[model samples]
Target: MAMGKTPGNRDDEGDEGVFAEINITPLTDIFLVLLIIFMVTSTVIVQQGPGGGAKAGLKVNLPKGGATDVTARSTDLSVAVLADGRYVLSGNVVTTDELKAAFDKARTENPETLVIVQADEGVPHGTVVQVMELAKKAGLAQLAIGVRDGE
Candidate 1:
């Protein structure tokens, strides 16, 4: 209140002077209330689980097409998009004309076949698109593009 009074000098006589120090009781009370509130709400947040983050809306699903005669190994077939917009399926460099034959033949064997495309990074974007279009037209539903992983 008044630093321990002035020794023998009684400024307020029997009365104690007003407290000049900040009363931290109210601050401590408020912080404790906030801490408890956060503790309760944090569990709710944790229970809600994690989301896909910024790519949440970018989720894509592979197509589910009709069952075919192709084996599961067909899923490992190579798809390459050439710089000249050629579609290569399983080592057979194909023009647009041969895509249907290759694709249908693959699909007719493996029902779970997926076409994963690996093209030169320097290749034209249209070439990649052409490969995807060809895969779709060939009755192969799942098309995944190969890319180098980032650091």
Candidate 2:
């Protein structure tokens, strides 16, 4: 007989009707937890360097080294050996002949220019050596093999 009360329900006993409003406390808690998880994961990813601090278009798993960081000038040259048997001089893809030409040009401008060779872990030893030999032939006296920190 009471308004919003089911039939046969006793009026003497005070009983609230079915709850029409949704309880958002648990939903809000779940969302907050997910947000916290995303925040932590994103920070971790940002802190970790790609390829151990060597940023290049080509993916190269550099060998680990115990050597400390050496000072490099802005004019220093970087050569990357790709996994597909290709070469990257500075940031451009080039053939062996083209690489040699670039090296020659760089040497002409700066004879003491340092050449840093970065080769992927799966790259053949012969390929790396050939690159080094080309650098030497190009008149570059200072050559350094790039590697990730051992730590």
Candidate 3:
């Protein structure tokens, strides 16, 4: 009678057990690549939309201007004037009184805060003036206008 060989011993059968451990290096590499691509594309879409405008709020067609780029700061307050005479403060649609109150609060928090008015090209000059006056009345001395870079 012949004796059976152990599992680890070399035998004439030349049989090896199934490979139970799975290699996940390739799978992990593929996932990382996909994640990187998604992150990059999302950033581009957020910064510059299909219209190539760096707008994070309401879509306003900024007029061309020769002014240089103004670096944004922490104390900067953004207000948007839509073509339909609506006011948007920091992305929220606000009434005139609410806008005034927001301006007052911002001024109280930081006397040197700068208000950047982003008005659509079709917005009337008078509407923009009213917003500016409100800001001034709120004691916000520093003010600026948002414009598209002249090309």
- What C-alpha lDDT do the candidate models reach, one value each? 0.68, 0.81, 0.85
Arranged by lDDT, best first: 3, 2, 1
TM-score of every model versus the real structure: 0.45, 0.55, 0.56
Whole-model lDDT, candidate 1?
0.68
Of candidate 2, the 10-residue stretch with the lowest lDDT total is: 49-58
Candidates arranged by TM-score, highest first:
3, 2, 1
Cα error of candidate 3 at position 12, Å: 99
Looking at model 3, which ten-residue stretch has the lowest summed lDDT? 1-10
Q: lDDT score of model 2?
A: 0.81
What is the lDDT, from 0 to 100, of the residue 30 in candidate 3?
Answer: 100
- Poorest stretch of ten by lDDT in candidate 1: 65-74
Q: Which stretches of candidate 1 lie over 4 Å from their true place?
A: 1-74, 149-151
| Cα lDDT of model 2 by residue, 1-151, tens digit | 1235454667856765654456688899999999999998876665575653324334656566855765568888888998888999768899999998988998999998999888987999999999989989988989988887798
Clashing pairs in 1: 69-108, 69-109, 70-108, 70-109, 70-110, 71-109, 71-110
Candidate 3 structure quality by residue, lDDT tens digits, 19-133: 5456688899999999999998988887776455455546666566756667669889999999999999877899999999999999889999999999998999999999999
Once model 3 is optimally superposed onto the true structure by TM-score, how far is the C-alpha of residue 112 displaced, in angstroms? Answer: 0.3
Please report how far candidate 3 places residue 132 from its true position, in Å: 0.3
